[model samples]
Target: MIEIKNLKKVYAGATVVNVPQLEIKKGESIGLVGNNGAGKTTLFRMILDLIRPESGEVLSNGYNVAGAEAWKNYTASYLDEGFLIDYLTPEEYFYFIGGLHQQNRAQVDETLLGLTDFFNGEILKKGKYIRDLSKGNQCKVGVGSCLLQKPELLMLDEPFANIDPSTQFRLKNILKTENKNNGVTTIVSSHDLNHVTDVCDRILLMEKGVIIKDIATSSSTLSELEEYFGVGQIVTPEIKVDKEENH
Candidate 1:
């Protein structure tokens, strides 16, 4: 449902993102993996049209993202806490978003009820502005908001980073259901290898602002990724020779 071509972004004389071409089909779950400065977030921003690419374009349903508003109707994304309305309470923010989507308060409540398990009893009636919540709780709020939208295309960045293990598990299940049962096209960028691999059908390994490997998920995908990231490699110390003594 999404296509990227000749996409490139640069910062301060350095190339940060340089994707030549990529495509994401409907109902597919894609995982983007990379270290810091790999340009994963940059790529995401370009897709969302939050940042204009220096060259090339992103297309959603064959319409250029840079030139269309139709894609926003079906896309939901939460990249960081910056996406939250920090001054508003979680409930208020959710209701506002719901209103924008033409969902009444009752509708919003019903949708939120379905996410009770995902919220883990920490979100609703918190009696605090979103800014006051902990980082993990804020992440929960962000993700929860995305679900309330019932988007056709969902994109999240580092979603597993701040949440607890149980919440992470719940989120993974939610993603799986959204992709498999609901046919949502999902693209998630994460540093958590295990979680990403478990939820995504395909993995894109990126480095130095380029996609280096794109692998279909399989029994061996995790180990292959770990090996690429040097998870289990052995390192031997270098030995020094006494050249003068030998002479």
Candidate 2:
């Protein structure tokens, strides 16, 4: 269970995140959606104790995230490439992270077996360092490492941003399967509305550092999101003119 109360963050005298109160029940899969600068990442950072909130607190299973060590045991998150070791190869990186979670080599190998199709054989081998892999591949490595931990609370930011379409589908299935089997609590933030809606059982819409909507996923959720997003927005197509024609 996750409990947030009066959480706030300020930067240069501007408030970026402010949540009076929120509770995420155990075994819930939640998707947070918002445009850039909506404070989605800020909220995740607070939850993971990566950033010090200006006020209030975040509690994971009754343990304050910033004040206790208990939450680290069952919570895992991948917000960006910074979580990965660019110097290590994917295989080496996995083993290193797995070791941190007290997973032996054989157990790590077993955990990785479930990710073969997600990797598409491109992540492992190829004799490349993590920094050398493409951004999409690096993201795969980060998410795979997080999953290897078998966390009770998993968090991801923009998980679909750098992945290919086919791999995105596979990753969704992976999360769904994990939820079905383990009831792991997941909170993932994404700009890709369709993908998040497809994976999450609940959707929270963030706007200007506030959660404006919290709705359960349903058959009509996509259309509802589309309708909500379409309000007061202008999408102008670029006009292209041939150089010769312009001359």
Candidate 3:
């Protein structure tokens, strides 16, 4: 459903993202994990057409994302709190997004009802603007808005970073259900290895603007990633590592 070809981005004479080629199929769940400056967010921005690539292109459903508006109809993304309207209350923000998708207030409320448990009783009717909420609560708002869209392709960046453990677990279940049951093409970039591994069927390890490893999630996927990041005691040989040069 998505394809990247020779995509590259540079700033201040340094290359930040340099993907040669990548493809994501419909209903696939992909996890992107990397340390600081790994270009995860940069790659996401290019895919979303928030930023133009210096070279190459990103395609969504056979159309170049840089020049197409059709993809936006089915794609939903939340990269950070910046995606939120800080001045608007959560309800108002959600309703506005719903309107953008031609959903009425009743429809938005019905969709939100499904997220009651995911919200953990902290998101709705809070009476405060989105900016006033805690970082974790703000994250909940961002993700909740994405779900309200019922998108075919969902992209979230560092979705588990600031949320409490309970919320993180709920979010993982939501993502898994979206992928498995709803057949959403989901791409999540996260630093939390366990959550990403549990939610995604494939994992991409990036570093220095390069995709150093792309491994199908397996029983040993988490261990392999931890080993690569030097957080595990043993490396699992079962995990395949696609080096940057091979790309």
For candidate 1, give the lDDT.
0.89
lDDT of 2 by residue, 29-95 (tens): 9999877888999999999999999999999999999999988989888999999999999999999
Each model's lDDT comes to 0.89, 0.88, 0.90
Report the CA-based lDDT of candidate 2 relative to the real structure. 0.88
Model 3: ten consecutive residues of lowest lDDT: 232-241
Q: Give the Cα-based TM-score of candidate 2 against the true structure.
A: 0.93
TM-score quality measure for candidate 1: 0.93
Give a tens-digit lDDT track for model 1, residues 7-118.
9998998888887878888888999998887899999999999999899999999989999999999999999999999999999999999999999999999989989998
Backbone N/Cα/C clashes per model: 0, 0, 0
Off by over 4 Å in 1: 231-247
TM-score of each: 0.93, 0.93, 0.93
List residue ranges in candidate 3 displaced over 4 A.
231-247
lDDT of 2 at 206: 77
Q: lDDT tens string, model 3, 61-127? A: 9999989899999999999999999999999999999999999999999999999998888989878
Steric clash pairs (candidate 3): none
* Candidate achieving the largest lDDT: 3
